[model samples]
Target: MTKESPLKTLIGLAQDDVDTAAQRLGRLQRERGEAEAQLQALITYRDEYHARFTESARAGMAAGSVRNFQAFIDTLDAAIGQQQRMLEQADARLEAAKPEWRRQKQKLGSYEVLQARSEATEARKSARREQRDADEHAARVLRMRASNP
Candidate 1:
């Protein structure tokens, strides 16, 4: 059995690492998107709630009710801020994974290039060996014919 090329093995391992990094990056991106969507939904709800409060105030809302709406809106704003921070963290992680993936991909490419060069070198050596053998056989045949004649 032919031995496996070490460079090929290194390439395979690097490819796997790159694939894993890509998957991680995809997950982080999805998480960031979900967080953004949630933040938007919360903002929308907060706007709609404030609009309702405004309408109620125009119609002369009770003092206690106005205080409660203000408190809840404050809480929503805090939650939105927290979600934004979470999304930022996720973005950072995804951004970090991108560089790791690129590095692995570059490593794999280098290994592939090395393997190609090695294969080409082996092919050239084999062709040279075959040509030398053919030449020797031809010389032997000519020598034999000349001696016989």
Candidate 2:
């Protein structure tokens, strides 16, 4: 079996790291989006509960069924409180993830930049070596012509 070149191995490792980081970043973004959606849904539920409680109170005054209506309203209020707490927790998680996501993205960018610079440096070095060889060939040709003439 042919062994892989060290440079190729290093490049492969770097590429793997980049791919892993990208996947992790994508997952974090998806999680954040899901968290936001859940929070929005909870807020909607909370609003619906509040509206129902208000209507129930108005109906209770007209129908003289205050006790049962108040109990229902209290239950809805408790549900709304629970949902609000959940929404706040989701928001907090999203906030905590933001900085970590940014840092990972920055790390990926820096790795790409370093790879590009290394490629450019290698190209420049190769070009310089080729130029030096061409110059030596020209000098040898000049010496041959001078010696023969």
TM-score for all models, in order of appearance: 0.88, 0.64
Clash counts per candidate, in order, are 0, 0
RMSD after CA superposition, every candidate:
1.8, 4.1
Query: Model 2: runs farther than 4 Å from truth?
Result: 1-64
Among all windows of ten consecutive residues in candidate 2, which has the lowest summed lDDT?
59-68
Highest TM-score scorer: 1
lDDT of each: 0.89, 0.70
- List residue ranges in candidate 1 displaced over 4 A: none
Query: Which residue pairs clash in candidate 1?
Result: none
Question: What is the Å distance of residue 34 in model 1 from its true position?
Answer: 1.7
On a 0 to 100 scale, what is the lDDT of residue 128 in model 1?
A: 100
For model 2, how does the per-residue alpha-carbon lDDT over 86-120 read when each residue is reduced to its tens digit?
Answer: 65776676666666666656666666676788789
> Deviation in angstroms for 114 in model 1?
0.7
